[model samples]
Target: MPDETLVDVWGLAPAVLVIMVGGLALGLVVAAVDRAVVSGEAGRAVVEPLLAGARGLVEQRRTTLAPDRLLWRIGCAAVPTLALLSLAVVPVGGRTLWSTSADLVWFNAMEALLWAAVWLVGWGPNAVHALTGGYRFLAQGLAYELPLMFALITAGLAAGSLRTTDVVAAQEGLWFVVTMPVAFVVFVAGAAAFAFWGPFAAPAAADIAGGVTSELSGVDRLLVDLGRAVFLGAAAAMAVALFLGGDAGPWLPGPLWFLLKTLAVVTALVWAGRRVPVLRPDRTVEVGWMVLVPLTLLQALAVAVLVLNGFYA
Candidate 1:
């Protein structure tokens, strides 16, 4: 039985690795596309200027905003760096790089750290807009984080383990979304808000004139932008793994199914970015904490009761 377990684990390893790498690569590609192909105005933009800006940053002279430049650079770079590291803990395609019975909890905790790093980045810059952006991010964080945690806990209670692979397997007949549709919706909203995408993208919106990113330029700006895309992809992938049964369908290989699901989520994010109205900061704060949080908690209680009653079985 141990040998069979090892073999099954080994078989799943490559697919997990591919998904992780693909998540990172997709992030960079999306950043490049955003810089080059997609513009805020939505028309009369081309990729050449974007590539030129990227190339110019590499060739241009470095500028310093602080006397202690090294710390500043580290501050801007650390968030995405840590966020990418945490993505490894998230399960994809029936496995993670390191699997633990408590992996789901660990994954959620690390994800929270990603937000901490974002606050650090904002504080590091020492600029007014950056500071304001950072505080806004924290406010938004408070609004969405509880719902996100409750959603994960709901899944954990339903699956009877904190292992993400077991969560996927538990949905063999029907995805959790089918039974816990409300929780699923809350999770997606929380994920999107945490990612700072679509209607929740107020911290980085153009009206704020690139709020957190306003003062950033050259390679520093590139890294920040790239990191945002990476976070988006990672969040979407986690959503797929947790609630969508992580490549459980037949016919196609597990990895392909996983990619398809992630793509769908990504497309939704991008479309929302284009269509949704940016929420005012006050309204966002109110809705996030008051409405979303209570709804998610209620869903968690509902799921817990269902699981206890053997509805999941």
Candidate 2:
């Protein structure tokens, strides 16, 4: 019996490995493909400018535009780096690479701090365009951030735990999206705006003819573009994990379900990028604050009432 059990365990190990590896590979590929598909006049208009700025920084003469050179450099590099680090704690599957109690709240807080870093980067550059971009980013950030937080809080309330894994487990029978459809939509819209994609691309728009990244060049620009793509992927993954019931499904496996859901969300963002015209900065900020924020908060309150009354149970 011992020998038979050992053999069965060995057989299952490979399958387990395949599922984990396949899920990761799928997420990366989908994100990359999404980026590639959108890399054109419409898309490249945003990316290419940043690349140009990075290249300019490297090849052109270095001019000290600001009094505090060190501060500027640090601001430019730190925001994206911090954003990547926060992603580490987010649970990808059965376990996160590093997780602690209440990790979900920590993750959200760290992720939100990224905007501050980005703002600093723009301000440190001391260029007209960069400053304008930074202010625009701040305006948009103010508008969407509250709604995003409410969405996350609603998920936590539903799960009754601040751990992402617990949240996923709580959705055994039905996804949170079904129970909180309005919150899901609100969260997605807020995330897209926060990430500066689609209609909210105003802060980095080519029509603003280069907003915050207008001054970046060479490797710095590359880093910014890469960071944006990675952020896009991460945000989509979060939405999948939170609302879609992270890896919950039948026959295929949990991780595959996770990847499929993430891909679908990322694809939608890319499609929206292509279909929607970039919004004016003023209009974008106005809509986000005046409309989406209150709507999301109300949705959260409804969700709280429903879950508390055991309607979702």
**Best-fitting candidate, scored by TM-score:** 1
For model 1 the local lDDT of residue 106 reads 81
Q: Which ten residues in a row have the lowest lDDT in candidate 2?
A: 1-10
Local lDDT at 130 for model 1: 70
TM-score of each candidate structure, all chains considered together: 0.84, 0.81
Quantify all predictions' global Cα lDDT against the true fold: 0.70, 0.67
Q: How far out, in Å, is residue 264 in model 2? A: 1.1
> Candidate 2 — which residues are off by over 4 angstroms?
1-64
Candidate 1 per-residue C-alpha lDDT over 1-313 given as tens digits, one digit per residue, 9 for 90 to 100: 0112222556666755565576667675445434433455434233543564476478543453662355557756765665575566556555666665686778777668767766665666667677677777888888778878888888888998887778888888889888777777777777667667667877777776766766677777766666677777777777788788888778999978987887777666566555768776678878877887888788888888888899988
lDDT tens digits, residue span 7-41, model 2: 14345556445434443343344445554666743
